[model samples]
Target: MKRILVVGVTGSGKSTLARALSNRLGLTYHEMDALYFDGPGWSVNSELVDDVSRLTAGSGWIIDSLGSPEVRDLLWDRADTVIWLDYPKRVVMPRVLRRSVRRTVTREVLFGGNRETWTGWLSREHPAWWSWSQHGTRRREVAHRTRDPRFAPLDTLRFGHPRDTEAWLSSL
Candidate 1:
């Protein structure tokens, strides 16, 4: 299970699971957001592809994203295993809401040193909003990607509920 990709829609706990798996498996953990966002104001990393390519070239890694569009295909091509958190909106909405609220309330710093703000919630890009709006689309995308012939060499584990994922993690 080396070179793993933890994939899910916004607020689906991709980072948390990927980090835990990395720790358990003693693999290098790479937070995709950290790699894509470079500084304050959510500045983007212009060299994202180069950075991701370099890291994926390594023998072992667990990245907590499907990858942004620019590097998505590269990630899927290199990954030996993919863990898909395919939880429905009912499960993810509350998780995302709570997470966004807590982060906004605490002014917690995130990737690129950006913090979620009350006003940010109004934006479509906000995690809460994104999770709600893109829930179905993201699910379909993941489903299609998993079935794609180009990625047939990859082993996939798809979990439909938090409990199932938790049980599997514990078993691991």
Candidate 2:
């Protein structure tokens, strides 16, 4: 599908799946975090909306998020297909924990040239903490949006587990 959005709770592999889909479908791939986070210190891009709007105006692309608050509606409105990774907290928590730990241990650079630090894990904004705290909320939000009339024209592919998603991907 063209103009795709990959949505899920943090660490649900949205980026991974979106990348694979983009490659397989030959569509341009856009990482939402890379678009929103500009430089070091996790600084935000002031032109996020404009940038997102310009990208979405194109005829084909795949983005790895529902978009930040300011551009969420625009993303949903323009998207033709939405792939929702709806794994349970049991599946997601360990993933997020391992990912954050690896990033911290390896000093892996991320969006905005930021790296996860041990001290940063203490904050509620940390990926592990955010994923654990917002898991249910994210699921509910995606669920509601999938059924919302405003996005009725959208086609949704919701996977409840990793294996299911993998099998579907392999098929494609």
Q: Model 2 misses residue 5 by how many Å?
A: 0.5
TM-score of each prediction? 0.98, 0.98
lDDT of model 2 at position 99: 90
lDDT of 1 by residue, 41-79 (tens): 889999999999999999999999878999999999999
RMSD of 2: 0.8
Q: Write the per-residue lDDT of candidate 2 for residues 1-172, one digit (tens) a residue.
A: 8999999999999999999998899999999999999998899999999999999999999999977899999999999999999999999989999999999999999998899999999999998899989888888899999999999799999999999999999999
How well does candidate 1 score on lDDT at residue 47? 96
Worst lDDT run of 10 residues, candidate 2, spans: 132-141
TM-score, cand. 1: 0.98
Give me the displacement of residue 27 in model 2, in angstroms: 0.6
